[model samples]
Target: MSDDMLRLLPWTTPDGKPCYLSAASDHSRLSLLADDVEAAQLDSGEQVLDGARAVLGDTKAGERAVRFALTRATESLEDVLRIAVSRGERIEAGET
Candidate 1:
């Protein structure tokens, strides 16, 4: 199948490579799972953003706290970007 026909799943493999789903339709079981995963990722990203902002706003937050928040924010950013790319591809393919 063409790359456009595949979906970039929310999770990756053990080797840190990207994962794709080849569902025939969006309502398939795998597709539904992916949808749930994507939603959770997005929700997590929002929570991360809120926590990072709180950490940044606190004047007494130590270096370790800032570093930890930065690390979490970076991970959430990667997830959100992946979700954006996946949805954008689907839209461009007229699958959305």
Candidate 2:
């Protein structure tokens, strides 16, 4: 398959390797599922960012609270970054 038709999925393997999808078409079943997953990930990332900001702004946020927020923010950042790379590749490949 051509690079234009291949897509980097929003998730990874059990061992932390990246996942990919060889979409048959724009509206393929797997492609649509991936789109849904990506959308959810993006939304979750936004929520995590907001919560992290709130935690940071809190004058009395304890160590545990700050740590938890930071951890969640880190995970969200990873997801968002992967999404960016995936989308960027698609655009560059003229698949957008």
Candidate 3:
């Protein structure tokens, strides 16, 4: 099947394995669940960004606090990028 038939879900399995659904319809139950998870992740990432900025801007924030904020921000960004890349790849394949 073409890569376009594969959809990436935001959340992983119970065992922490990445979950991917192979189907042509984006309106399927699994697809809708994935969409919901993606929306939650995006919202979480935004919160992380805001908190990270606050921590960075605070003069009294300790190194450990800043480090933790940065770490969380990095992880959130990575997840967002992975989702974007997966969608982008499918789009690119479709255009070729």
Candidate 4:
């Protein structure tokens, strides 16, 4: 990965899962996970491949699989106010 790609922006999906967006050569991909998605116990790609092959039914599926978890967080007063300012006017009572 290049330096530009390494600079990720932490975010969350609509379902509330923690995630990060990173730029790639061919695409921009997002990973939603419980912890630091980039830091895995397996340091080397080869090690990951070997372990995955043993556990997963298919090596390809294992390679493609990603782990993630949904979470909720409390917003600070400032953040709440900022959010309210941004969208407070757009919302209409009883309109979902």
Q: Which stretches of candidate 1 lie over 4 Å from their true place?
A: 1-4
Most accurate candidate by lDDT: 1
The TM-score ranking, best first, is 1, 2, 3, 4
Cα-lDDT of candidate 2 = 0.87
The number of the candidate with the highest TM-score is: 1
**Per-residue lDDT tens digits of candidate 2, residues 1-96?**
253467889999999999988865768788789889999999998999899999999999999999999999999989988989988888877743
Which clashing pairs does model 3 show?
A: none
lDDT of 3 by residue, 1-96 (tens): 263567667766899677778877777788788778777878999999999999999999999999999999998997797678667856776777
Ranking by lDDT: 1, 2, 3, 4
TM-score of each: 0.92, 0.90, 0.80, 0.20
TM-score for predicted model 1 compared with the true structure: 0.92
11-95, model 1: which lDDT tens digit per residue? 8999989999987688889889989999999999999999999999999999999999999999999999999998888887774
Q: Who is ahead in TM-score, 3 or 4?
A: 3
- On a 0 to 1 TM-score scale, where does candidate 2 land against the true structure? 0.90
What's the count of clashing pairs in each model shown?
0, 0, 0, 0
lDDT of 1 at 89: 80
Poorly placed runs, candidate 2 (over 4 Å): 1-4
Better of 1 and 2 by TM-score: 1
